[model samples]
Target: MSVLPLIFTSGWASGINAYAVVLLFGVFGATGLTDEVPEALQRPDVLIAAGVLFLCEAVADKIPYVDSLWDSVHTVIRPVAGAVVGALLAGQSGSVPELAAGAVGGSTALVSHLVKAGTRMAINTSPEPFSNVIMSTTEDLGVAGIITFAIFHPVGAAVVAGTLLVLGTVTALFLVSRIRAFLRRRAQRRAERRAGQAVGPPV
Candidate 1:
């Protein structure tokens, strides 16, 4: 019954979509739906801002290259958000140091962010945009499900989320070579197209 599970799960979720994580905690905390959230996040302004940002991210995360761009921009933001959320969660119990929670959250977020960014880099190489859309939707839903579960069944949620995070990072690392090969192939194709254009018609 330690709150570590909820904190860890939230930190992991924040890495994927910090705004959604913030919005979830804020709304749920404000509504008294769950006692696990911190009062600091229950403020009206925090909830509104998080909700707006979540909307913005929802749109940006569906595009092809745009999603990658968004991820790059959030390289710092997401991890920081994760740390902040973790610190807040820890403050509720008074048994843990907020700094310690922040460190855990930040580190977990960084790992998850790398996996997400690397996967998006690979996915961007695809010609069709459908895969990007599907992946984005899947991530959003995954975050949502994890947060909701953490509310009522924190330990179970933490286990499941941690498993996925580890799996994703490992898979992304394994696919690095494949991703590099894909980029090389794409560059070659582009070069061939340019060469063809330079040579002009056979005449």
Candidate 2:
């Protein structure tokens, strides 16, 4: 029940598209991100698997241009995560209804990922060196979280993930528009102040 809330809240708040992106570049052959940890915590194989996945994500991120390359390769990665989500849902469920759930999961993830990647690309176009790195690291953790949820709690995870995706994308658009308006108003105020100075006390 507790995990259910995490799954639900994070699912919606995290954005489906971003969750998709995380899976796109990170899920393939990477076991730890989605692998279930044995409750016992005594399994050597589980430990090894966890270590390897973390190492790959960490190492890949460190190589200056590797992140870009990874992104390029993941063009297909987003869809694949969706497919996996679909398949998982279908397997756990029965008939057309179950399959539909998978499709929804996959599609939600795809949309969420698209928005997130587009936003990140726009932000990175600026010349700030550290901004991209900081963004990438944060996103990586997000990806890990999504995967963990997908693997461990499919139904609850799907509901939460889907909700988060919708909420995030919508909220992001609202925030962006608000910020632009604020900036425009600020700019106008500055212009008015400048004109007042030039007018020289209305004389």
Candidate 3:
């Protein structure tokens, strides 16, 4: 089977939660749940590192500005992870197939990562904190679902991932104006508060 399916699926998952994808692959490979898992991923050090990072992400992703910062930091990490996963799935090194797989994975991951990061930035403009938690949780669940399914049915998972990528990108971009409005409102509120404080209490 061509590695394209896994490449796309991993790419999408990496955009949402690269550490979780890595941890899943490491755990699956370590436990012998699947043969397609990579040997390096099965290493204890890799598993530990991915696990720790995943934990940090799980917490940071639920905070507003913190989540944006986290996404910015991972802009590179996620795409790199996608490429690595693709190369492993290709089952070769330095060959044309592996290189192509890496390119596909990296490109796909970049698109989804941009969508995820942009959406999160937009969401952060709101004053409510719960939305961040809700969205982050949903994304984490989505990544888990897709990666788990990809292990057995890569083609189906790829289709789902592709659909999601397109829809999410469109939706986030559509909300840009609204996010800007929210930011304006929040800024106005802050300015009003500052002005009130500056004037001192009326006698």
Candidate 4:
């Protein structure tokens, strides 16, 4: 069977948390849970780096506005990670062209990343911080679950990932107005802060 399904699932997960995907895949590969993961990801240094970054993200992703800032930084990283992982998977499997797999993975990751980032922006508008923590935890669990499942049942996991991608996109679209408003308010607040600093206590 083609490795496309696994690639698709990984891409979807990568959008939300690329480091987690790498860490999990590395652990699974090192433990002999599966051989589909590329050797580069199984290296001890790679696993350690991914683990540390995953820890950083886990903390940063639970903070209200901080999560949004982190997402902004990862806009390019996530998609690129997805493409590289996909190409590596294709090379290992030899069941699909590297370019095709990379394209699929990169595009899927980009779409899902947008959905995640947009949704987080909308969530950030909430006054309480609990929502950010809840959402972040849920995303982490969802990524871990789907990646684990993909190792056992690639096509089924792909279906789940695809369904989630669609639902998330739709939800993000529904919350577009809120996200826009949030951005406006945040920008305005930053501007006000800057102005205040510039005035320097009216001196």
Give the winner by TM-score: 1 or 2. 1
Candidate 2, residue 126: Cα displacement in angstroms equals 2.8
For candidate 1, the lDDT comes to: 0.89
Q: On residues 10-98, what C-alpha lDDT tens digit does candidate 3 reach at each position?
A: 98898889899989988877887888777888889999999999999999999999999999998999999898888887763333388
Against the hidden reference, what TM-scores do the models get? 0.89, 0.48, 0.86, 0.88
| Tens-digit lDDT track of model 2 for 30-100 | 44543322222224554455456556645554344565455455455555555454444344333335355
Candidate 1: stretches off by over 4 Å: 185-203
The per-residue C-alpha lDDT of model 3 at residue 63 equals 96
Q: Write the per-residue lDDT of candidate 1 for residues 138-162, one digit (tens) a residue.
A: 9999999999999999899999989
Per-model RMSD to reference: 2.9, 8.9, 3.9, 5.4
Tell me the whole-model lDDT of each prediction, alpha carbons only. Answer: 0.89, 0.49, 0.88, 0.94
What's the lDDT for candidate 2? 0.49
Clashes of 2: 15
Model 2 Cα shift for residue 138 (angstroms): 1.9
TM-score of model 1 relative to the true fold? Answer: 0.89
Model 1 superposed RMSD (Cα):
2.9
Tens digits of per-residue lDDT, candidate 4, 36-145, equal: 99899999999999999999999999999999999999999999999988998999899999999999888899999999999998888799999999999999999999
Output the worst ten-in-a-row residue range by lDDT, candidate 1. 1-10
Query: Distance (Å) between predicted and true CA of 105, model 1?
Result: 0.9
